[model samples]
Target: MTVKQLSSSGQFNILCMPEPEREIDGVYIGDLLSWVMGKAEADNVWITIMSNINVIAVASLSDVSCVLLAEDVTLESDVLNTAKEKGINILSTPLSAYEAALKVSGMI
Candidate 1:
């Protein structure tokens, strides 16, 4: 499923979607920045409770289609700006990481 389609499913709130049409190939759930950077695949939806500037950098380096912020975690203003500038798509949900992953799994 595409990022846009997933966002429209009402499971998440759109934070910044610079590439909503980007396709989701899979899901990666992690909070460790370095581990996620090394393991997350291109076009995968990275699910995490992390909401920092480094998260943006890792997402860029990992080339994930989007960052799914679980537990309604949100990036700071500066980090959100950086994400927009880098064309990183982001979404947030009230569910925990595992719950969010289940939702995404069912979708894509």
Candidate 2:
């Protein structure tokens, strides 16, 4: 599924969607930035509760299609703006990481 399609489905809230047409090829769930940076594949829908500025950096470095902020986790204005400026797609959901993964699994 594409980032725009996923956000339009109402499963997640769009925080920063500079690349809304980006396609989601897979899902990666984790909180540790280092681990995620290594494990998250390009075009994967990364699911995590981390809302820090580094999350944006890791997302860019990992080349993930989008960052799924689980459990309603939110980013600060500066981080959100950075995500927008960096052309990173960041989404949020009220569901836990596992639950959100399940939902993404069904969708993809």
Model 2 RMSD to the real structure? 0.6
The TM-score measured for candidate 2 stands at 0.97
Candidate 2, which segments miss by more than 4 Å at Cα? none
lDDT of 2 by residue, 1-108 (tens): 899998998788998899989999899999999999888899999999888899999999899999999999988999999999999999999999999999888898
Q: 22-104, model 1: which lDDT tens digit per residue? A: 99989999999989988889999999998878998899989999999999887899999999999999999999999999999
Q: Which ten residues in a row have the lowest lDDT in candidate 1?
A: 70-79
Backbone collisions counted per model: 0, 0
TM-score for each model: 0.97, 0.97
Q: What is the lDDT of residue 71 in candidate 1?
A: 92
How far off is residue 8 in model 1, in Å?
A: 0.2
